[model samples]
Every structure is written in structure tokens, then in C-alpha cells.
Target: MKQRLLLATLICLPLSVLAQDSGTQSVDNEALTVYGRANVSLQSSDEGDGSYSDLESNSSRFGLKGKGQLKDQLEVFYQIEFGIDLADFDEGDDAVSNRNQVVGLRGSFGEVMLGRYDTFLKDSQGSVDAFTDYEADLKSLFRGENRPDNTVTYYSPSFNHFKVGGTFIASGDETGDDGISVGIIYGDKKLKKTPFYAALAIDRDVADYDIEQVTVATKLGATIVGAALQQFERTDGLYNSDGYLLSASHPVKQWVFKAQYQAVKYDSDKDASISVGADYFFNADTRVYAWYTGRECDIQLYQSRGCGASNGVEQDFLAVGIRHDFSW
Candidate 1:
């Protein structure tokens, strides 16, 4: 009698578990999102002779992104983005600028996107650089940082804090060369307390350009630090250049303090820049910033040491602006 009762109890347990699981299943809601950021700033820069000021729109954009559920392990997604210039009202037909526009499939394996978008080399840098759209942006001293049209990209699923991505560009340009870019990144952004990210990337044959870059960033409590190094080679190794950057930021309450230093060298011409800035956030979608940047460059005749010292020119940049972003 005891064995029969025990067997009956086990038979009922499976049904009870199944009922609980069915009750917890979530209802799917198919939704599309509209997102955008409107950023404008009053900026001024001095180049030894005098200071110049201008009202500018810094990467203001609008975009639509959506994903549809297909199966348990796969989905379809697409995004279309356009840049707007708030400072220019009479630009006529060139007013609307094209940004990232892509459609792709995502699955347990990874993702594949095809359209106009940024290269894997540029995406590998992520949010490492504190100053992106400002005067001291990394692109000011680096090469091959771009978003191109007619591109295909792939990203691998992360495993053990490691992931890889690649991009191919089929742009019909004067160089008559196809572009290839690839990168590998480590560490997950969800980590807390001591999260770290590192990446290495290479780009070739994009408008007769070839470049290799390495970037790393880490967060320790409230402090973030990042660094990057790049080598540029072109014309079958006949020309070569290199650049490096170092940056750090600390956040306190609603404010963030940031600083960066960068240097680039090509032949005998060398340029170096340093910038310091602060930002105040009103909320998650709005903020104000002030920054100061200074640069010095020298042109040499024979790639000799200490050349063009007297011919060097110094420049300075200062800006204060507000940025707002919205999404639905």
C-alpha cells in the first residue's frame, strides 16, 4: 500500500509543474520603435591668430528600428537612420543626410546585416572615446573611421567573453577596390564593478586605404579609462602613418569629468592634441557639456628630428552645448 501511494504522488507532480510553467509564459507584443537625438552646440576655436565661433549641429539624427519574432531562436530586424542639420536651414537638397540603414537577421548563432552602415573597425571602438562628435574626436587624428554605403556585416555570438565581427563594402569608387574590415572584441558590457572591453581591427582596400587598430576600455567603480593605437598603410606600403589616444572619465551624481590626449604621425608631420571636458545630465535623455581642446602640429621637410619647430601652429577649441534624445 505504501509503494502504491508513493507512485501516485509522483504521477501528479509532473502535471502540477506543467501547469505552473504554462501560467508563467509571457504574451508577445510586436512593436516598432522611433528614436532620435537632437544635438546642437555653440562652439569656438582659436588658431593662434584669432578665435572663431560657430553654431553647429553635431550628429543630430532620427531613426526607426524594429524586430519581429520568427521562432524561438531566430528573428528579423531592420533600422533606418537619417541625420538632420539644425544649424542649416537653406542647405536645399543636401539637408537630409543618410546615416545607418540596414536590415538583418539575428539568431542563436549571431547576426548578419547588409546595407549602409559603419565598418566593423569603427564599431569596435564602441563608446571608449569620451569625445566623439566634438572637435577633439578620434577621427580628427585617425584614418579609416567611416560609415560606408553598400556594405555587409556579420557579428558572432559572444562565448566566454569573446566575440568577432566583420564588414565588406562593395562601393564602386575610383580606386576600383572592394573594402574588407574585421574585428574581435572581448568582455561583456553587462559586467559590474570591474568590466573591461578590448578590440583589434583591420581595414583594407577602402578607397585605397589600409589600417589596423587596437582599442581597450575598462570601468572601475565610477572611473572609466580607454586607449587606442592605429597604423595606416597605403599605396602598397609606400606610405605609413600611426596614431594613439588615451582618455579617462569619472562620473559623480549628474556630472561627468573627462580628459583625453592624442598624437598622430605621418612622414615628418606630427600633430598632438589634448582636451578636457565636463558634462551635466538633466535626465537620461538630455545633457549639457563644456569642453576645451588644444592642438599643435609641425611639418617637416626631411623627416628629421626637431624639424619644423618654428613653423608649428597651435590651435584651441572651446564649446558648451546641450543635447537631447528621445525614443518610443
Candidate 2:
């Protein structure tokens, strides 16, 4: 009950402030925007056993974002985003989870944000993952994909198509080791105005692993191709792993076709996955999509990482869904 109240307060407080200020200021310089997306799918899944049908909610979320002028060339910004599960309305904390809730300042020096958010290494991936938030998300085969609390991040202003950023994760009193992440990126992640994008990032002691990753994507005509390679080492020096991803997508009018391949190897254990999907757009804000992904995993990987199945088992998923995004 207390958690619910706290969350409600956090959400409503900003709106109340916006209401009081909007009447006297320009909406463009000081305004609050409510935005979110709903993404749900029906899936036929097999986890190395029998097949079953289920409905899945793919990280659907809603939030409020606002920015206010603070001075001559400075601004204060904030966002309160939360994840909602639409497939099953279970009670308790699982019903709603935090996403990128943060408060920050931006100016000529760039931006500095505080609170819970994705690390620099994680953000460096950008939109290269063709199957993000789905069964084939890069998090399934790679380390350093972290969104941790008690974080402080800084992003430098773009200089000649290049930018750099860093994140510091405070371990609090419970843990003595602090985590750090850093990244350098070039070009635009959306590829809307740029022909190519590239990023190199590193994480140390975040989520109990050290990781180095490189990601690149290029737009050729109407097609986009992306790839990523990563190396992960356990902070305790007990294990080391490597992974790579290749993905491509092509759009024809209102239809898009996508495919991806990814694999990870650790010692003698290996896991690999393949996925194919397509999307049909009703408009810019809505789309319907379907995808199929299959994976083969080694037992050793299951024991050590709690991923995949024992004895080189295979798992598969086929899903179709609709997504609608809205902003106000």
C-alpha cells in the first residue's frame, strides 16, 4: 500500500506543478507530455518441452516527461516512466515496474542525469537490436545490458558527429565496489539523417560482469543492417564469454521484413539463436507484427548463467501482436 501511494504521488506531483506553471509560460518551453506504448502479443512457445500458447506483454510503458527553462542557456528535465503488464493483471509489485525514471539538467556542457536509468554501455547499443524487448533481445545472449538504480550519468554534446558519455553506479552501503560504464558513439542511431552509426562501450563491475562491446549499423537505400560483438568476463574471474549479433531489415511501403542471428560462447558451452519477423504499419503510431525465434542451448550454460536448457535443448517461439504509441 505504501509503495502504491509513493508511486502515485511521484506521478501526480509533476502534473500538478505543470498545471500551475503552464498558464503563465509558453507551452513549448515549459510543458509536460504524457506518452506511452501498448505492445501485447499472443505466442506459441516451446521451452524444450511441450508447446503452449500464451499472451505476452512486451515491456509496454507510459510516462510523463517535461522540461523547464532554468536560466539563459540551461534547462531542467524529468521523466517518470513505468512498465505495465497487460497480459496478466497480477497484484503486488510485479504489476508495475520502474523504467527510466530520472531528473536531469542540460546545457552547453551537455546533460547530467540522476536516478535509475540504463547505463552508458547499454544505451550505446541504440536501435541496433532488431528484436528488442522480445524473445530475441540482445540481453538474452550478452552481458552488461543493465538499468540500475542509484546512478549518475553524463553525456557530452555532439562534436563533429561524435559524442561521449559515462555512467557511475553507486553500490550504496551494502556493496563496496562501485560500477562504471563509458561509451563513445558516432552518427545517428535512427539513421534518419545519417548513413551510418557506430559505438564502442565498456562496463566494469556492473551486474557482476565486465564487458566490452562494439555496435555498428548502416543504411543502404531502404534497407538497414546492424551488427554487434561483445566480450564478457565475470568480475570474480570465474568465467569469460563472447557473443555476436547480426540483424537486417528492409521496408517496402507499409511493410517491413526483418531477420537476426546471434550466438554466445563460454568455455565449452555455446548457445545460438535465429529469428525472422515482419511488420505492417497502419500508420506512424500503430503497427501489427509477427516473428519466430528458435534457440539451441548447452546444459553448461543453463547451470552457470541460468539461461537456456540442459543437455543442448532447443526452444522456440512464434508470436503476432499489435502495438500503438501515443503522446499528449
Candidate 3:
């Protein structure tokens, strides 16, 4: 009787363990994820007036991103991030971090995000950059979307050949302007070519001013290019506008030869300007770049208080720099 009781106990134990695991399977596989990145480099800048040199810390940073499945039809997700700038050299404390937070949800319709995050155009700019980070050849010059504070965003699933996204900025709690931006990116899988992109953005203040930006970008092999034309208007009759950039790259083993040209036309009769540059890449994440930029600005006669059309002058700039990317 004792041996039979022990055998039955062992059999029941296995059945009990199976029942517990079956009930907890869903809990063990709960939806969640984590990811991050980091980077650093050396750079130099020459604006024709002077040359500045320093080792710049790229977006050496990290963060947590994940989602939780509440049911078959509903789920929630979020991301919080920050940068680490090693350029300071002093590692003790004086570090600064900026606009790197994101939160959102996915549903049957689409995904809606709210937090301090990059606007859509931000990623588009990086697509064409030799170095798509702080150490990048033209990062400051590009001024892509990057991250913004108190922003709301939405991303939609692809419809045939297009994937679309939009973002709204302006918590009104800060000095920033209220803006809405939208973009459409088209993929051509059949052609085996890079996708094409187009975007329109508008920003305004209820009683003060307004502005608009329209952009287009595309890439072919080692060449990536983009353009953004923007118009700014204010109640005081102040109008301003400008746009330009052309680029190409050829990769040979570990090195790349790149060329770029840019032009700018100003509303103030600043005469059109043109720029050209070249770079050699050591790798996909790093490169050394140099540029020659020239600009012609109009002069105003002190006596006539009007434009002196012929007084246009030109300034030349020679620039050299290195770029790198980081992810942690």
C-alpha cells in the first residue's frame, strides 16, 4: 500500500507541474524589449572667418524601449533616452543631455506617440549624411529634425508602396513655436533603389508670426541628397528664406570619395551663394570632410537707405572635419 501511494504521489506531482507551467506561459512571454547606442569622434570647423578645432563627443547614449501586450487587440509602448557627451573631457559631472524621451501605443488602427522625440524630417536628413551623428560632416549645417520637447507623433503602416508619419510640436509651455509636420516616404522594392521622400511643415503663433518648410530627399547608391525651402513671415513685414545641397559619394574598399555642392538664395537680396565639398570615409560611421563655401551679400547705401545692388561682396570658407556615430 505504501509503494502504491508513493508512485501515485510522483505521478500527481508531474501533472501539477505541467498545469502550473501551462497557466504561466502567457505571463513568461509578456511583451517587453530594451535597446540603446553610443558614439564619439574628432572634428574641426572653418567658417571663413576663423577655424575651430576640438574632439567632439557624438550622441554616445543609451535608453530603454519596450511594449506590453494587454490583450490581442491592445498594447502600450514607451522609450526614455539620453546622450553622453565625452567632448567635455572632464568626466566628473558637467555633462549635458537633451530632448531624448518617447512614449506611445499600438492599436488596430495605428500607433500614436507622445514625448520628447525627433520629428519626422530628422531621420530624413541623416539618410544623406556622410556621418549621421554629432561628429557628422554637416550635422550642424543640416539641422535635421532630431528630438523635440513635448511632441506628439503618429506612424502608419504601409499602404502598397508608401509609409507615412506626422508630428505635432508646441506644448506652449516653452518658448518654442507651434508646429505640425507630415511626411510621405515611398519604397520601390521592385527597382531595388532607395526610397523617395517628401514633406511639408508649418509653424505659427496665434498673434505673432508664421513659417513654412517643404522638403524632398532621395538616395542612389553612395549618393544621398536633400533640399528644404522655408519661408518665414511675421506681422512686422519681416520675410526670410533660403535653401541648398547636392552630394555624391563613391566607395572603394575601406575608403570613400565624396563631393558636395550647395547654393543659397536669400530674400534680403543677399545674392545667391554656392558651396562645394569633398570627403574621404574611413568607414560607414566615420570620415574626414573639407568644404569650400562662398556667399555674396548685398549692401545697403547709408545715404539712400536702400539696397545697393552692385555692392555685392563675396567671402570664401575652407573647412575640414571628422565625423563619427555612437549607439549604446
Specify the highest-lDDT model's number.
2
Residue range 309-328, candidate 2, lDDT tens digits? 44468888999999999999
After aligning candidate 2 to the native by TM-score, how far in Å is the CA of 283 from where it should be?
0.5
| Backbone clashes, candidate 2 | 0
Distance from true location, Cα of 196 in model 2, Å = 0.7
User: Where is model 1 more than 4 Å wrong at Cα?
Assistant: 1-29, 89-93, 173-175, 189-194, 236-238, 299-311
lDDT of 1 by residue, 1-328 (tens): 3323422332343334344334343424368899998888998977666888988788899999998765565667899999998876673556689999998767665777778989889988977778988888888767777799878777878888788877877756565656778879887542352379889999877646788999988877778888999988774666677889999999889999999998878766787789999999999899999999888766442121212243377878889999999999
Better of 2 and 3 by TM-score: 2
TM-scores for candidates 1 onward, in order: 0.84, 0.89, 0.63
Error of model 1, residue 240, in angstroms? 1.2
- Model 2 TM-score (2 dp): 0.89
Please identify model 2 stretches exceeding 4 Å from their true place. 1-29, 90-93, 299-306, 309-311
Q: Which scores higher on TM-score, 1 or 3?
A: 1
Error of model 1, residue 138, in angstroms: 0.5
